[model samples]
Target chain A: MTERAVCVIGTGLIGGSLMRTAGKAGRTVWGTSDSPDTAEEARADGFDVTTDTDAALRRAAEDDALVVLAVPLPALPGVLRRVDAVAPTCRLTDTVSVKVAVADHVARYAPSARFVGGHPMAGTAESGWAAGQAGLFTGAAWVVAADDGLDLDVWADVAELAWACGARVVPAAADEHDLAVARVSHLPHLLAAVLAAVGAAGEDDLPLALAASSFADGTRVAGTRPELVLAMCEGNRDALLGAVDDALGRLGAMRGALASTGGLAATVNAGYAGRQRWAAARDPEAVRVRRSRLALPALREVGRRGDAVVGWTE
Target chain B: MTERAVCVIGTGLIGGSLMRTAGKAGRTVWGTSDSPDTAEEARADGFDVTTDTDAALRRAAEDDALVVLAVPLPALPGVLRRVDAVAPTCRLTDTVSVKVAVADHVARYAPSARFVGGHPMAGTAESGWAAGQAGLFTGAAWVVAADDGLDLDVWADVAELAWACGARVVPAAADEHDLAVARVSHLPHLLAAVLAAVGAAGEDDLPLALAASSFADGTRVAGTRPELVLAMCEGNRDALLGAVDDALGRLGAMRGALASTGGLAATVNAGYAGRQRWAAARDPEAVRVRRSRLALPALREVGRRGDAVVGWTE
Candidate 1:
């Protein structure tokens, strides 16, 4: 069937990005915001938007539009309940970070809507509609969760939507998605935060001043919005905890081995080899040929001056 | 006193870089190598080079040249003893990551030579003569250690050498420098290693494939030369252990709080704030102006036509 109008219920980063992508794809897009100021901002950005959620959902239902819930976790249930009251017959989807909770809530509150969970693995630490970009999800993995409560045909449509926005569709069970993300995303964020805190909480700012590219890269995620990060940590608490424990056990072993045998070469080598292999596998086309070095002219002129024989400029 | 010709007793990344910088500064530089092949490499790169240690030291002595011990930590003592036997009157310095050991070794093995410990805080995972660059030390902090046995005037000359190479000379006590780098450098390496190992040791490579910029950044140091990284960890063992413990305490508290209180916003916020302050303090001149986003023109025209509702050529 031809694509129908998409009602984006929240126009923050993810939703705004979806609307922008959909607009670029020549689809009719309607958006709503949590506040009048945001609604005004979205409208100013050329979106057909409003602060009236019930009216928007009812209009979406009347038009047989696809409704996308793209609000924060704490706000999802109320939105679902509102959707059930006004737009139950319309097919629905969501862009939430954690899937298991979203699946459960969708089942209980909007059972009449055929729903699948989506999580486009894109975006920066910055949020809000202001942070949105038309190409936000391009080249990213947009997870189309196959939650048992979700419908197969609807998921195909959801996957198609993801593809339309230039994302690779990754099908996964809700719990599996949550577990994978907790390990890949949440655990790293927590560790980075701790690392940054360690840098700041030191005897002084020496560590911070001495923090080069490596330290900055290692802790970049720690500088993200705390509220959003805390939400992910809370939502995937168990899996994140497991990942933390696993990493800590290995690191503690590395420290002990360093103290004793003067060897952690095995671990370091493994990591180096793994990253090389992973990079090769992920982008086979980008592998570079071996590079050559050194071919210059020779020179030597010797002289002596003082006890400090090497030249000093200042 | 006029600066004299210098002999560099290794031709790896750091040594080659120093030779290149000194060459650019119009000093006659002679470089030694572990083997003939490396000496050839240096010669091809336009360096006055030698493979014979005694021959190199004697040449340095005859010219009243300064000597830079640019070998690995394990190789330093032997080179220092060789300097004592052949060029004892020539003042000396070294480019080793750790400092206290270098200070002690200099005191014991090269008593007649004025010695100062140095560490140019620059470089990448790539090493050897092939990785050398003329401006490697530019904009970097080149630590000049104030070991009790080290001559103050020799250090001033050494600091001037660093300055002439376009570096900012940071004067510090040997132990203090060791402790600071332990907290900043070694600890980050350990964490990145463990983090990369965690990514590799997962159930599959999905985590690796999905590893984004954050994971890549956080684990970058893990991809550096395993042998060199191993040396840093082992050389700075005591200070590294202290940093590890301190970071673990904070991280464990974060994990525990995440598991129990359903509230870690405070800790996350603290870390976020810390990174911002650290970054601002680290590069105050580079602070960016705030940017605004989005005010696109509105448009919406929705309809459906089969799978073609969204145009797809694939």
Candidate 2:
């Protein structure tokens, strides 16, 4: 197989990691950052880096190459405009979490480029080039947006990049991507923030100190960057609003059940069943992989060596 | 310190752990389980165990020991009734999560005993004798509730037991304990279960597979025992209902703000600030202690070492 040339614009975590992974996969990789300092940092970290958008775009415009837009949502239009000027013939994709606005903008501004709105549903709270990891997208989902007149080979190349990075590609329309993320991602962040607010409202120091593993787990996403959350919510307002309403409606129904004479048991049973179904829906392999990666080697070894014990009664 | 003779009536996670911790602290500990198999297991595990409720209560009455009702909320009244029949003079306490209904029931049924409602805000998802750990309550919060006439020394003894298990005792009314837990614990579980339902509702397998650390963290509690969750919600119906309403109202307001023409940035900023403030409200030392205990030693060591370099800026 011929190796593809990959150009990643914006040398942040997503961009840098894509360049590194593609390079490791024997692809010719070039990357660009906003500033000279970041560009130098990326180069020092072994990425072929430039500060010039046109140079990066020109590199992507070459034969059998792909361009990745790994910048923030707000920066996408400008980046696409640059790509239009310098790499009009190149196949383009993105790593932005939100897709609706960016998809509309790309359709309007860079009609000539073979644009596929993509979101690798993976990341940490940490950002910047230094936080880049080669296996960051491994076993993650890369959503490829559905659009009209999209080239099959270009889509295949994009999907191949995701596969090479060990991500599972899921085909979706831009609106579906927006809605799914709003339900799973954005709404969780909002709920976490609200939980935090409630937790902080009281003056007692004991309750806060008494907050356990569940509290920590539930509020983890509340620590994410406010600006980014705001951007996603703003950029996909309709979808997020709908998801929020859906969640609240569910919560209201639960509350109503709790208030009724027999409602408490029914609500609790629903919650219990919901949890079981949720756990079943989760990928056991992914969970096992993550647990192995995060746990101490001793624990991992014990788990590996342990004999399986099963009770038939259950 | 006088070695208090304590009789723990239940061999589950809470009871077994309490027995071990109490034994470790040089207290004379005796435990009983409802099942013969559990009693045998507890005995084999080095706990003094019995299956005869009357014999266990007789022992408690003879020794004037503290009686810990560590059974489920639904089982509390029956357990108290049995205890009243055998050890009416003993100072009674419990480790139930929901307090209001249990307290009221005990007040009416076993009013002669100095019944102090207690909740040790600590546990793992695992239950029964094998799952018990000596350090289960370490760095946890123990909430104690009593009527006006309880002896101060008995209260102190209970507090001391909590302290010996490496927990900080927080005094609260039974009603207050119920309400507080409803907000912090019950509501979060409900939210997690509902969120999991939403994620499961999606047809594409990508979302579940692509779910990251954030998703896992948020949904951890949703995978716990549905029976226990249902019991808590059922037992503390009013409080849980109130908490659900509070949470939904806040979430609805946030959704409305995001949906409005005024833009989502301001609302999201407010949430961001709210989360930061919430995190700040926690006692750092307590958090560190708890995290160290739960996480692997290597991760704990990393946290310890990193504390010097990365002071929590937020």
Candidate 3:
């Protein structure tokens, strides 16, 4: 079967990369950027990019192209409103960092759109069309929302797009994705911020000057642009709260142990074991059942077992 | 004047590296390792190494060599006892990670030794003599203690050795050095451990597989051996407690803002600014005042201002 056409709205890092990847994979791909400069850059790079979202969505609706919302969280509502106005029933998914918030926005603004939330767990600490690369998603996990009562056809379409972009699909509920990212991504960002701030609190430059590999690695993400960090951390506030609480609980116990015993054997050993497990974990074997054998429950079970959807047979 | 002879009491990563660095700089250098395997490896590499601490100390006393106690915190007292038995009045310093604890150990066990605390803020996670490299301390800060009443003659001897090994000397008080490292080094290790454990708590590979640069960088140091981490964190308990308290306070506030207002602007912004400051900082200009113009207070003031001692004039 010929690949479905792709319509990407917002040709910055994620969107521009996806457009390039899909086009390179032989799909009919076009994208729109709110920044005319970015659109021009993408077009100059031989991509079909424009500054008109309306035209992009209308073309997607007419050609049955997959519409990918690639805007940041703060820009999601406006883009969804445009999707509602131009292609309310278009096959849609997004590349936003937070899922449940985007799902809620889709339900409110583009109610009839066949939307499945997605977040490609890949990126560099860079922005703009210039930073986008065709191979960015290769070997990365692309999470696809598998919330119950969803259309499997649209779900498969999204997963196919991810696979076409050289990604493996991990099926998860929107809420679960938010929670997982909160633990792995969002909480790390916040902790990095705190760590960086504390390191600098000395105001003497001694600590900063003395900082070595550990300090650099721990605060690496804290160097990300504040606005981007704010959007992700705030957008997933509910889930991040839970993660923060968990970290705080662990830290509190660690502090108590240190104060009393002067030994961090427990915290250090647990963390050491955790790191070892992370090193030991190879990806679970990929799964490919027939389309008839797959459902939301099976997909979720595969995700819980840490397996990725590699393909589906007839 | 010719360079003084050097003797290192540990031949693990730091000690072995220092021995190589000193020997390459034309200093007469030899070392001892508790591990026979490590000592054999060092000896096979054409360096003078042994497992006999008593013999090493006796040789140092006879040659008046600058004796570097490069053992871990737990091994400091045992090594110092050997120094007391064979070389109680020898010129002494150490490369232990913690400053105050080592100072206390030296005072109690080798009181007559002209002692100065030292810690070269450099290393890799890998240990053992084979992992040591000659350029390990090149351009790194080798902190030499400037505590009150410290014999400037012995302090100068230690600083001269650090400079001879290609490191710039940062003179700081033992307590001050402890506090500084607690913020930049030890604290970061603990936080990395917590972050790693929290991330792995999911008991599913999804978070680990989905983890990208942020997670990897944040938890990088947690992959170090737990015993090493415990030694550093537990050895610097009082200062680490203060640093951890500061981190927890900031985290609590961040959580409050996230829970109540759903905005991490304060934490994220402070962190961004902190990271910006770190990026903007250049190594401070080196100072080389005359020996007559330098004292413990003056050296510490230079350290507080983040300056390094590149040399000293007659």
Candidate 4:
């Protein structure tokens, strides 16, 4: 593996995870954090940590290093300004959840730096300097967005970093990355929050106590850092909105099917069909294999019990 | 602890969990299954198990034991019919997910038997004879529904079983139980199944492979027994439909908020407010303490920064 110096700014979950992985991969890794305590903690944990943003940026500027902006979305503009002031010639990348806004901000403020908007679709609810794990991005998807003007070699280096962290690489436009995440990630978070709220509603401890695994799983993301979720939602508002709308439309149809007096069997069948259709559309091959292995047998068993108690029409 | 004999019919997850807990609590537990292998397995696991429903029912009839119908909803009618013929005098109860349907069936088919409908809102995705755990119902909620004409002692016994198994007891009408489960349990299952279906539709392997804890948690129940879910949906169509509708309406509103020019800040604010409201409604004491905790400076660091950005509104 070709050796590359990597400067990870922010020293948060994403930044810390990357540092740990890169250091393990034998890459020269340096990190910076605003909090001196966090910087000291990272250093104690074996990361070459620093508190000076300019010093970190200057190091990247002096070497052929990859500079990753792993800060929160709201903090991006300020961080980008600092990067531009100190490391105008360094190759830049980011691990922001929402890409379009940050891409726009970079284009406006730090146009001189060779930039690629990226998002590693992986994380836990835990955050900050101490929560970083070496394998956090293992088997995760790394969304990379680059324009035609960027050097192919620089793109490959960033892509290599993603691969080193055990992430599969996917090429997406900044807008597409933002939109897809809004649907797959952000909307789910909001839905979980809403569901949690619903479960928590009323003085009925029975319902809350009765909340089983489904409740726990459904609301897991709702319990995440409320501010961070809020920022992601705010940053990728249009896309998240579209996703929420699409989800609502689908949910409404399901509700309507259930409400109809045409029998519960039919409604369940419709739900099953809709789910199958959506899954097929999202990933046909995996769905085909999984449906065969797990879901098909169960469906067949239900079918064999009796002839078409409920069926779906295209 | 009283040493009363309890017959658990259909030795699957729910039934086996009950038997394990009852046995540990000093109850003489007897179990029956249609398959001789399962019966033998349950018996080998220390319960007095039998394949012959008649023999089990006769034994319960002779002993005046509590007969728990822990079979699928569709199988309930057939089981009730058999129990009617063999154990007509035994105190009857059930662990069905949907109560209204079972209650109605019992009322019509075995009107003479002292019957109560029950649902223990606790389980794992794993099922069958092997998946039963003694602590399965621990810290969970048990819903009990009985008519005024039934024996109070039997009701107390069932409630005691729930407590002995480490579950909190909650009383509701059969209809109420069905409605509440529809909202808190059934709808979430549908959502998970749908979301899984959506992820399964992705063309690339990355999304499915990269599906982290959030995706796994969100879709856990969707990966459950399709037959069981279909049965629950069919059995509690009206209530599930109503809950799905409520969820859809809320999702739509969220989507609309996101799509608006102001974007996600408003939607997030609403979600935060909704969660707070829900928490307050469900457990005022917990919510009060949470609010107080949120007010503390140490916790404020982790509190949502977006609320300030979104600002307070009506």
Candidate 5:
């Protein structure tokens, strides 16, 4: 049996890392980059990277390769249009931060493509092909769309690719994935932004001067590039807005409690318990099933139960 | 002249670390712990530790030691009372998280002591003497009181001790220090708690399962002991309330902009700029002065300019 091929479009951190990871797993992986400099650098690093997207899509279609859209949200439509023109029935997925938007773009621009949206929850704040490396996805949760009536074969292909990259496959609906990430990832970014701004507004630089590990940890992601943060927080506007509302409600309650009772035992205790819950679920129980008998709803249920797909026996 | 003797009350993480640090710096240091287990452990670790608070205070007064109160806010009053009874005129300071409250406690209990409030802005989530180590204050900021009419000699003693412990002295008034920490330290704890709670409330454990570095970083401090968090935050109620109001205002604005304009460029950009400012001031310019020539207002102005005291060349 031949290892499935992977065609990645984009050579940023996520895309480039996927390309390296897939190739290292002996998959026939190649990538395309819009930036000539990025393509040259990846090629110089001995990866098959090109500036031509249509040719890559054509080859991917001919070879029945998985076409992973690795571009930012703003670049999605153009790449999807090329996929439509060159490989309308290709096995398609994406590495975008948000999932539902990618699914919508594929429906509009490449409706015939077999799309299984994916997002590998891994990255540093760095960008470009140079920052890409193998094992970037090791131990990370890779979300794959588990919406109803999806192509199980293509979903399997995407999930297997994630597995080969050393990631645990978390089957979730596109909308659910977006909301979950908004709560965990995007909301943290927004909160970090607000905390950093408030801490910086202190008179006499005293706050920053006395800032310790807690302040540093809380604002770590606020140091991420502004454009990238904007793309993430803004791309999932509805979900993030909801998450923000939840956070604001919590903060408002905390403020009220602090102001009225001069105490926040309830908030602090709840947070402590929440943190304990996260710690307890850090290494979730592994769920295994045969790929031949894999049911989408059942797999989604495993994810819902805080279990990760660690194996799919043949 | 020989190094001034040091006496520490409350042998917890901060206190235990100070005992080791001062001993290593060639000062005659001793500490008392209310917890017999903690005192026994510290004594076994080759330091002079006892469970007798009054005896330690009496010796400190006899030896003209700089008495350091390293107790939590709740234990502060009882320890301060001992200082009043046994060493009312001794050189006094503290390592409490909140300065204003400790100052108030000192005024109400041990008013005649030559007191100069101090707080080392360094610690871990772990508590107790077993978690303590030498050099804990290395490269950290140790804030010393610079309120009007402070005993400059005792202030110099506290500042010199911080220097010996490998920390830069940040001269700030008690009220100013409380307000500043309310922004940097206490407020982050609250935000982390709120964030942890919000993230944990996600449906189906999806958010926790998909939590990544950003979520982990933002909620890192939420794992701290709730009692410790409560003490620090509640101890500085007025200042923390003001800080919480500021944060809530920013979060509210972020939610409004994200909901209406579907854009948070302003928030993200401002946060990025704030993070940049923090990075710039990380290794502040060094301010050196002779101990004799150091004026209280001038030293505080140095701190206001984000400069750290690195030397006191005679």
Candidate 6:
């Protein structure tokens, strides 16, 4: 097989960060953005970015390079259709936060191409081309999955992409990925928004001046681009709704037991113990799979629980 | 007024930090703790601490000192009654997390001595004597108030105590302070606990592994001492319930608007705008009065918004 370069579509935060990371790794990288201004800004920031998606796809078709599908959920099916029509030989993966819906769409529409799903669990309240930094994924979880039969070599290439961005590749099933993020990411976004709205709910309520450190940190993600928050919350609506229900049920029980000081204290102490264990067990810096940033992986363990090796299974 | 020594009752996080800071400022200080082990820890950390409450009160009465009532809410009324019986000559201030309820209790129970209320907005998830640091209040707000009339000399001593710990004195009304903290501080605690409980609710629920940067920040305060959270929540139950109801209402609206992309986006955008305005307008570092940290205040402004000056009106 001829050498394939890395091609990234959609120069937003994840795509832009990958482009910069790949460029820094001395790989031939290309990127494209939806907005003309963003495309120009990416170009000015030393990226090979273009506004024309078709032209970029044609180039990738000629090169047979690996394509990174890093667009919003609503735009994914159409983008995959365009890619399948143009670059059938390209093995592709994505940075979509959810995996199941897109994996199903890819399996049906792009049956000729090898594609896996990925989500790098590092993001900030900032968005767009300007907000994307090369170091954004440093010590971040890059969750990857390929439910369909893809060549082991192609999966290795996707893992390489994660390493290029200073990320640790943790492979998991698509359903598992969706369920985990709904509780951890999506639920927190809506909760933050709820708290922010509560602060200003009434003219006489909660003067923002008294919003101390706890309040600021608690609602940090509510300040992210609203369009992105809405897209994400709506994209994983089912899992998010379930998580919300779980949280509401827990809160309802707390309300009932509030008068009993011992009961509330027990829950609070349990949470503290759980958090301490999480901090020790889930250190991102320790999640790497021993493959150096510049080297390819040996693909030893296809499925396991991210224990100093790539955690994935059939 | 005669030279007043600093006497901090309850050598916990706030009180311990104040004692350390006052010691650094070359002031003589005494501390009392409810727990024998905690008193031993404070003394080990170079504090003049004891477990005998009555002896500490007698010392404060003889020294003609400013007593800092830094006990938990459930213990505050009883502590104050002891003060009224034993040390009525001492001018007192408190570091209680909530203000209005304690102020009411003070008026009803200890009308003989002049008393002021205080709350230092700086806190961490960690608690107890070991968690205290001299720099805890270096750039924090020390909120003070007295619903009843206070002697200007005693109020100055209290303000001096705040500056000794490198905090800006921000005087606010007790009712206004409770309302503000109810929305910002208290509601966030319940929400954090609810989310933590939700994390481990169902058998197949969120793995703490997926609790990434956002989730961790959103629930940081949940890991704080449960007893402290219980006292603050129960002490300000009425205000907290109102804030929770407001938050639940906003969340209910979001749940309805989840089907409509534009509607959800608008609420998120409004929250972003509000947070931005808060960051710009509500900078704590810039909220200090022009009086030098070591100088006595001109008492320039007492009844305005908390925009770089004290916001208390007679």
Question: Across all candidates, what is each one's fraction of true contacts kept?
Answer: 0.50, 0.46, 0.75, 0.31, 0.85, 0.42
Pick by TM-score: which candidate is best? 5
**Number of backbone collisions per candidate:** 7, 0, 0, 7, 0, 4
Model 6, stretches more than 4 Å misplaced?
A1-4, A104-111, A148-153, A202-206, A259-263, A283-314, B1-3, B107-109, B146-153, B202-206, B259-263, B284-304, B308-314
TM-score of chain A of each: 0.86, 0.85, 0.97, 0.84, 0.98, 0.88
Candidate with best lDDT: 5
Task: Give per-residue CA lDDT, model 6, range A255-286, as digits (tens).
Answer: 55654442466556666665565566465324
In candidate 4, stretches whose alpha carbon ends up further than 4 angstroms from where it belongs are: A35-51, A146-149, A166-176, A262-314, B40-47, B146-149, B202-206, B265-314
- lDDT string, candidate 2, B245-277, tens digits: 767777777776776672665445555665676
Model 4, residue A186: C-alpha shift (Å) = 2.0
lDDT of 4 by residue, B1-314 (tens): 34568999999999999999988988888889998899888877777888889998999999989899999988988888888899886788888899889988998777778886778878887888899999998766677664445565666667667777887555565665676677678878877756664544444333343345666677767756678887777788877777776677667666666655545554455555554543443321111112112222321121111011011112
**What is the per-residue lDDT of model 5 for residues B1-314, given as tens digits with 9 covering 90 to 100?**
33899999988889999999999998999999887888888889999998998999899989999999998898888888888899999999899999889888889998999999999999998988888889799999999888888898898899889988999988888888898899899999989998899889966888899999999999999999999999889999999999999998998888888878888999999888888888888987888888777688987887787778876776
Segments in model 3 whose C-alpha atoms lie over 4 Å from true places: A291-293, B291-293
- Model 5, residue A175: distance off in Å is 1.4
| TM-score of model 1 vs. true structure | 0.85
Which parts of model 2 have CA positions greater than 4 angstroms off?
A146-148, A283-314, B146-148, B202-210, B284-314
| Model 3: DockQ vs. true structure | 0.74
Clashing pairs in 5: none
Q: How do the predictions measure up, each by TM-score?
A: 0.85, 0.85, 0.96, 0.81, 0.98, 0.87
Error of 1 at B16 (Å): 2.3
Clashes of 5: 0
Q: Is the docking of candidate 3 incorrect, acceptable, medium or high quality?
A: medium
Report the C-alpha lDDT of model 1 over B1-314, residue by residue, as the tens digit: 35777789998999999999989998888889988898898888778888899999999889877788888888888898899999987878888888887887887888889777888888887899989999998877676665444565565567567766787655566776677787677777877877777766655444554566667777778778888887766777777778888888877777678778867776687779768866785542211111121111100001000000111112
- Per-residue lDDT tens digits for candidate 4, residues A159-227, read 678878877555555665565576567767877776776655434444554566787678778767778
- Candidate with better lDDT, 1 vs 2: 1
**Each candidate's DockQ score against the native complex?**
0.21, 0.26, 0.74, 0.20, 0.88, 0.40
Supply the TM-score for candidate 6: 0.87
